[model samples]
Target: MFRFAMLTLVAAVSAVGAAQAVVALDPVRGATALAAVWREGAPPPQVQDRAAILKSADGHYWAEGEIQGRPVRFLVDTGATTVALTQEDARRLGYDTEALVYGQKVLTAAGEARAAVVKLPAVSIAGASVSDVDAMIVEKGLETSLLGMSYLGRLSGFEATRTSLVLQP
Candidate 1:
């Protein structure tokens, strides 16, 4: 009688194991069942693609970016139409300040100034990057390089809080 009871228990266990094996073989059905169980719990956390720039002590958003693989510091300026590079920064990026044609006249905080339009092969800040970006080399009156609309406009979105500028690429 004991041997018969042991055989019955073994058969029951084998049947349960076979049932689980069958369920595991069908991935779509297993996923559907998992989704149903998951619905009862809190939703999974979403993945966010974003970068942030903290406000500087000078009360402006500043970012460390790269141009032609060289590091550059930029002042985030939404007011500017295109990225504005100072003569020093342009030189640092290997641009010959003397050769660039400064025919475009632009109004600056100091006064009117001449600028030379140039196309950057690539520019990247944090994780956001852009190719063939329109930029200008300010002949004068630009204290720092400006990260302007030309780069920001390509992003999915951006927002400014009192403490930081959040970039969504």
Candidate 2:
């Protein structure tokens, strides 16, 4: 009976450790603790170094990010091959739009638009940063700044769910 009880205890401990291991690997580490409370009716676990989580509203995941060391809101877009900025956003980031050479013709959802291709000194999101990123400044017809592969591609990984997006830096 003693031996059987010891084996059961070992199995229980292993199972608990496995659960924590799985949670540790999650992109949004805080979600693990939140999920534990939601799933197992336990208290929320203390989370450290949690990943930034963005919830989708209106079918888009928006995030707060930094570009050129300035705060900007981003529309996380995996479809975009490179980061795209609106003329106003570029100005907000202290770019001289009048001097920007709009020589690149790029096709957009709004048809053909002339864009200025520029190398960003650095782009950071959720503490992960990439320097010398290629980005395009759309002079017209684009509403929001896009956080594209130029930035997202630098991360170790990111995960998307139906209602939320997790950025791992």
Candidate 3:
């Protein structure tokens, strides 16, 4: 019984642990097709992890502990209208670029930039979850991941008090 329970628990966690980020394939296909694809072959698995990014330590950020285990660096940028990712990060996430739907123009600190809008299956940050997140595929050089209003705004809100900005989300 103990062994069965442990095995069940492991199976459950493994099945849903990654569900925080769900990918939706357009024009849904039947399970048969999906099974066929799986039986044949598919791309490599993407590394997923979760870690903390802190400021008290210095102007430091770590890419390890992202919500779904994807590498990410958090940045506080009000100038940005949305949480954004560099192209490198997108590549790290297995975005299936061939299926990407191109989108609009954006103005960046550097200058006007062309960005392809892609909906992240899901983006989990600081225990806060948001799905169908609108993110820009950064085309230029960026210092860190832009934690803009799109994701932050969905959270309760942020307020600065003395030493640190209190992020309620």
Candidate 4:
């Protein structure tokens, strides 16, 4: 089942050179596909500039990234308009959470939440990188930090398969 899903995803991604279509799967199929991908996931060998493959994790695509010279974990989330972070995660990434000015109202599963806008110097995933990213610090209702369009929209393209997500810088 997992292998089949991976192959399906790979074929879809390769066809368009972007995974935007893969993410459209219904929740159950999406989750299954993600699990299969992560089970066999590994970073691409012989790293190339602005190109890399990321495997899914648990039911989501995750990546080890850097912000402000500190390592950070990111949950790839295209649904999110901008990079959204928990205050705790922001602090860990060296952002002065206490100094942040929360002024934006955003909707979350938990209800309305406030967010603080901030600029990230740079964020790198595997060998590809993007700079001057716009992000938001949500004080609550968010369980994980997300790498959203603020970063993804900057990419030349990205593709997804049941087994992996390919990023083009």
Candidate 5:
């Protein structure tokens, strides 16, 4: 009876230990966390050491920051009439692009497609604050999104000085 009880206790302890394994999510270290899981030998993400944050000489602007603790690279594009993101980036932001109200037909490099318009409550760039910024969450196979005039135009002044874009809001 004593041996039987000890065996049962060992089994229960082993089961509990197996259940407590903790899996870690490293945004910088997990490069293909989105792209692959089943595939073999995906590269590990190297955390970026931003030397200088990006700002544009053009009117549009964005600051590199964490979205759900992941690295994001943004560009200021005044040429783009509206704020836009590729479909994949939107998904990373926890947005289902297909379900959002796609309010416009945009002329993209590929072709015309439905684009969902969204307003970001707060977007800060280089210690500057801009609120209620009109933005878009794009859907799949995206090159990149342009932080465009729709958001930048609302700023007090967006100008190109010598080396940097001056954004006054």
Candidate 6:
């Protein structure tokens, strides 16, 4: 009777293992069924590091980012070396434009201008964030804030298509 009970237990374990194998091999079972069998009815979690930005009519990529929990618009400029903020935008974000020393001279589309270098505590775009980003406050000749390489370089990758830009973090 003891040998018979052991044999029955082994057979029962083998049956359960074979059922799982069949569930894994069967295409009709699908992922939902497989999840039910393997994960106690919980679906697999998805984790992706991608954000897409649609191109504007003016043939530029624009992104809306947050600095200190406040929204700021930026023209994505791959040619720019660091994130450049307009003096107005800087002021809106609580920076005192008059007090900041404009010691950095940089070239803009309009002409050469002086800028103040500042480190942002954090900048977030489309759920991706970078902390302690180096940025500049252009004193003049900047119509729009720029999202430049300082932030983009920290990302894993980015690509531009005809209609959109995809950012990989």
Give lDDT tens digits, candidate 5, residues 81-146: 445666776777777766898645454444345567687665554444567766655443335555
Q: All predictions: root-mean-square deviation over Cα? A: 26.0, 16.1, 17.5, 9.2, 22.3, 24.1
Q: What is the per-residue lDDT of model 3 for residues 1-169, given as tens digits with 9 covering 90 to 100? A: 3345324423432343211111112234521100000000111122233222233333211222153468565544333346666566777787654555544444444444445677676676544556667666655534345555566456555443222333444
What is the TM-score of each predicted model, taking all chains together? Answer: 0.69, 0.66, 0.54, 0.69, 0.54, 0.69
- After superposition, the stretches of candidate 1 with alpha carbons farther than 4 Å from their true spots are 1-48
- Per-residue lDDT of 44-136 in model 4, one digit per residue for the tens? 532465455555444446666778777766766554457777777798887787788877665554545667888888887776789999888
Q: What clash count goes with each model?
A: 0, 0, 4, 7, 3, 0
TM-score of 2: 0.66
lDDT of 4 at 103: 70
Kindly provide the TM-score of model 5 when superposed on the true structure, using C-alpha atoms.
0.54
Cα lDDT for residue 98, candidate 4 = 78
lDDT of 6 by residue, 1-169 (tens): 3345324423432444311110111235432101001111111122276776666554445677789888887766554557888888899999999999987766555656778889999988776688889888888877778777678768777766556556776
RMSD of 3: 17.5
Residue 111 of candidate 5: its Cα lDDT? 39
- By lDDT rank, best first, the candidates go 6, 1, 4, 2, 5, 3
Ranked by TM-score, top first: 6, 4, 1, 2, 5, 3
Model 3 spans > 4 angstroms off: 1-67, 97-103, 107-112
lDDT of 1 by residue, 29-105 (tens): 43111000000111112225777777555444567888998887776655445788889989999999999998676
Model 2 per-residue lDDT tens digits across residues 1-169:
3345324423432443211110111234432110000011111122244345444333445666678778766665554557777788899899999998987655544545667889999987656667898888877756667676677667666665444445555
